[model samples]
Target: MIEYCLTVLGFVLAIVGRMDNLRGFVVLPKRWIVERFFAHLMRSRRLVRDFERSTTSAEAMIYWSMTMLMTRRLARQPPRRG
Candidate 1:
């Protein structure tokens, strides 16, 4: 039991050590991601304002809107006959 716990602890530490270090000033990840999502939302008039009465519904709507946009985009591609 002791050996197993030590091995697992070491493995966890090794994985943590290899993770990316955010040391420099840069555009925060959430801001960029949310901005792109909002851009997609702007394309839909219904998403322009908060129509959903609840936060959960608002989030669900965002996911639904993005998925719809992605499906339309994928559908627009012409298939190769070859």
Candidate 2:
């Protein structure tokens, strides 16, 4: 029983070591990403604001647009198999 426990603990530690490497590899550049995102937003700021205010309709259009955008994005992504 003691040897079985030791082997299982070592196996868990090995898997955890690889997880640490993956964590480092997955971290992205925060500053550059924020700057690029803001630049893109600024480019379309006027157009988006104008469209948002042009109609006196309810906010459903905005919500619908966001839902469709997210749905399309999710649909385009590949499925993850367990």
TM-score of each: 0.49, 0.28
Q: How would you encode candidate 1's per-residue C-alpha lDDT over 1-82 as one tens digit per residue?
A: 5566578765322121322576665656556787887799988776888788999988888888889999999889698797
Clashing pairs in 2: none
Model 2: per-residue lDDT, tens digit, 1-82?
A: 5566578765322121233545344524555576665454444434346456445442555555556656777889697899
Question: Which pairs clash in model 1?
Answer: none
- As a TM-score, model 2 comes out at 0.28
List runs of model 2 lying over 4 Å from the truth: 1-58, 79-82
